[model samples]
Target chain A: MDRSEIENLIARVALKDRAAFDQLYDRVSAKLFGVCLRVLNKRAAAEDAMQDTFVKIWKNADRYSANGLSPMTWLITIARNTSIDRLRARKKGHQDIDTPGFELIAPGLNPEQAVVAASEASRLSGCLDTLEEDRGKAIRGAYLDGETYADLADRFGVPLNTMRTWLRRGLIALRECMSQ
Target chain B: MTEQTDIPRDDDVLAAELVLGLASDKDVIDGRRRMSTDAAFAGQVVFWQERLTAMTDGIDPVKPPARVKKKLLAQVFPKTRVSVLQRVWLWQGVSMASLLFAGYLGVQLLEMNTRPGTQPTVLAAQLVSDTSGLQVLAVVEPVKHEIALRRISGEVIPNRVFELWAILPDQAPVSLGVLPDSETVRVLVPEALRSQAAQFTLAISDEPIGGSPTGAPTGAVLAAGSMTEL
Candidate 1:
């Protein structure tokens, strides 16, 4: 995706320009739907999630540029978070993950310099593959499955604090591998 | 900077944990608040977000079924809905047929007007619409500013009421009132519209039991015609 092009569309959408919103949806909906499907797994549920994701995009577009993340990150993160919110709602007593405060930032500040170039970001999958067997699964399960530490501890049959420590260490190693 | 030791800083772990949603509810809430106030901590969170979001780069884009876009756009930009009666009146253009029908009713009414002077006593119109059997003959008593109506055809749809309206040129349809269940009914014209009564096109719409909640004609127009001088 052309980052600036997506950014430009978002800026227009912030102004409530319907044409730009339509263009932006055409440009990114396929990718966002893919992300929703990955997290939700059911076709109908994923479709619903995708709808909600766009509603949020239309409503929150004004808040986008102030958020420090890149445009695609802002969008995909919304799809991921919306699907996960729906997923958690299905189960009884599951803790609701609040939509993350991605918009919390000083106005006029852009994080373009801090953003990992798309090329280097692609190394993330390879980095995950290089991790010791269980570590990769743990990270993916937590990130994609919306599993909490308690859920992970039960799945891996470890103590709760142990799961936390394990995930913390796994993240550190994963970060190191990605940077390489 | 990469962590040189086995352990890393609390903010790094917190940011990563927060991104993956591994943080507890309380911690996540606090994390959100901190991200708003603490720019450095916010950048740490964004770094993980950018990296982790790339995990989906492998997920192939599936062109969604077309209905999704259709549904989305309808919700986003809804056009004012045109009712079946309005479509007949506006698009199928039964308005000309209505005028012809009104002229026929007018001639008959004129022959019956034996007790008249120069002043017109009764103005008449035949409310007719195509494709629906609904037809009405409206006799406007010009002096009293009242209209007496009798249904010629079509049944009052169950649970729906017929509402009378006076439509003037280039203006919205104004509600006269809901027609009673009986075939013959009388409706008083608003004093504001008394002068325009000579040039008025009266219409009836099928509305909810109490009539259109909004003042305008919200339901399907059953029948309509321009008043003819008798």
Candidate 2:
């Protein structure tokens, strides 16, 4: 998908253009549905999550530029985060990830850093492999499985403190490897 | 919900934890607030979101079911264009059955080109309706076996064609044909219904571009009137 085309559609959608919104849905829904399905791991839940994702997209497209994420990243984040919210909602007293489109623009990455970050994003898979196998699984399980620190501690049979320490080290190592 | 006392809270790791949803519930809330004020923290959070999101790159796109779109459109656009305009059509007066007849009468008169008062129409009906600006004058020319119509107000809906229907006393409506987007139209009277032309009620229905596929009128009846002898 052409990044500019998606960006153009999001800009048009921000203006409340229904035709552009429709086109945008057609262009991006499959990829978003896939992301939702990966996180939710159920057909019905994923479908509902995808629906909610689009509703958010329509409501939040105007804020896309202000959030300063790539168009696809912004959208997939919504889908992923929405699906994870549903996954965690099954557990009582759970909090959702930051609502879609509300991601604060990080100041650390300049345009050049952003280019580096984009390349780093592509390095993510390799970096995951470079981490200790258990750490890699812990990261994936927390992200893809919506595992909280307590949940990870339960799953990995570590104390909650140990789980947090282990996962933080994994993230630090992964970040370092990607930067390299 | 208190900050974890495990290790010194590394901002980069905390940002990663927040993006990964590993943050404690209270931390999730606190982290989000901090991101707004601390651009560096916010930037790290965004950077992590970007990097973590690529994890789904291996997931194959799945085209959702067609019904999903159907249900979504229904949810999003609950009020159809017609209801949004609040433009109801047909029978500002007259009983329901007879009102439906005006569509039939209009169908019979649709093809004849009779000017008002040129010669007395064998039959005529003035079609008007509540919540509508539609006013059509239809007349049956007996000799030509045709119906002549003059639209005085209202309009053809964009992208929608208007259809003419003929309704007899108790029978289902029979389609005349799709009406052109013109002020005046001439429609041939169906040979079978000519005997009941005086009792015919003509109606106009809003339909798709090529008109209704089901021989009967398939859309909202916009105008209708029962025929009266000149």
Candidate 3:
């Protein structure tokens, strides 16, 4: 749905319309759930947090103000906060969260992302190819593996500052490459 | 320093590094803050967001389970109304059902053509609940004949009722009537009422379970809005 449609529905939801609220859930739950999963790093916990976030949305719908932030931003704020809350609670000792192995946690894209990917694949592919092999590895490792610059530095037997420079230069090259 | 003020080159370097996931947590945090506050930084952010935004292309699309959506819907719309009293004054009143009616009322009152030609001439003041941020009271349309009072259904406190009142210039507030329900709530604007409305206000007061004990607004004013012509 478009921004206006989402905003309109949210306004209706503020008035306690069950149908509009359901429609909003149908539209944004997948992407929002993915965000929850990313932060909590577990499926079941993410699901729980997602449900809690929606409940908050339902109760607090009347509190939304269209000052500057978009509806997605507002919704994402709630989801992120909910996931963070659950994570904090888990840190205090809930062990039921099933964190998958790193290999099993394959980078998953949702539909909006898929469309963006489909449109920009060739350009990005060419850009990724232009970076030096090691530099590309450094960037990909830090990003996809969620590793730190120090980790990349240690993994590659390089100085931390040197690793940082490589990623920086690699990104510059990639930007230039993609624009071309 | 004077020769190095042209920082697009430096910005490009920083943005690319940030996008490549090379920036420190501090770097990322500071950069995002700057992006929001600085226009130059915002442009760089848009450029980087566009470039890195494409990386999702390599990932596979994952469809979550059907139960996920069902769970979400249930969470957002829990099937429960705690009261046997199926009727209450709606508080957060910006319903889509009412917006069209408001627009029509606006046209009939103003006689001024809207949209495609009309401009937002009036600063429409819908009385908002300061705590809940809900637009509870509003001047739906200020017509020569009538003014619609738009309010939602679940706004009334269990033991309270709402009574509408119109404040007049150089005069005390005038009691309109009790808000019976959500649907039929049009208040007649006394023909002489318009000239003074700009200087006056629309208000609602909480009354007894039925209505105001005193024929005037005896309880706390729930919501109020200033009237203006556009």
On TM-score, the candidate that comes out on top is 2
Per-model chain A TM: 0.87, 0.94, 0.52
Worst 10 residues of 3 chain A by lDDT: A96-105
**lDDT (Cα, 0-100) at A112 in candidate 3:** 56
Model 2 Cα lDDT, one tens digit per residue, A6-27 = 9899987776566788899899
Q: What residue pairs are clashing in model 3?
A: B89-B153, B89-B155, B90-B152, B90-B153, B90-B154, B90-B155, B91-B155
Model 1: per-residue Cα lDDT over B1-230, one tens digit each:
12243455489888888888787677777887888888778777777887888877788888777888777876765422212223333323344433433343445433434335633545677799996778777777655567878665577766788999999999999999999876578799999989888789999998999989989888888899997754
- Stretches > 4 Å off in candidate 3: A1-21, A31-42, A45-122, B1-9, B16-22, B66-230
Error of 3 at B174 (Å): 6.9
**For residue A156, what is the lDDT in candidate 3?**
93
The CAPRI classification for model 1 reads as acceptable
The stretch of ten residues in a row with the least summed lDDT in candidate 1 chain B is B79-88
Per-candidate DockQ values are: 0.31, 0.36, 0.16
Q: Rate the local accuracy (lDDT) of all candidates.
A: 0.76, 0.78, 0.57
Off by over 4 Å in 1: A66-68, A93-101, A107-112, A115-120, B1-9, B79-230
Top-DockQ candidate index: 2
How does the DockQ of candidate 2 come out? 0.36
Error of 1 at B149 (Å): 35
What iRMS does model 1 reach? 5.8
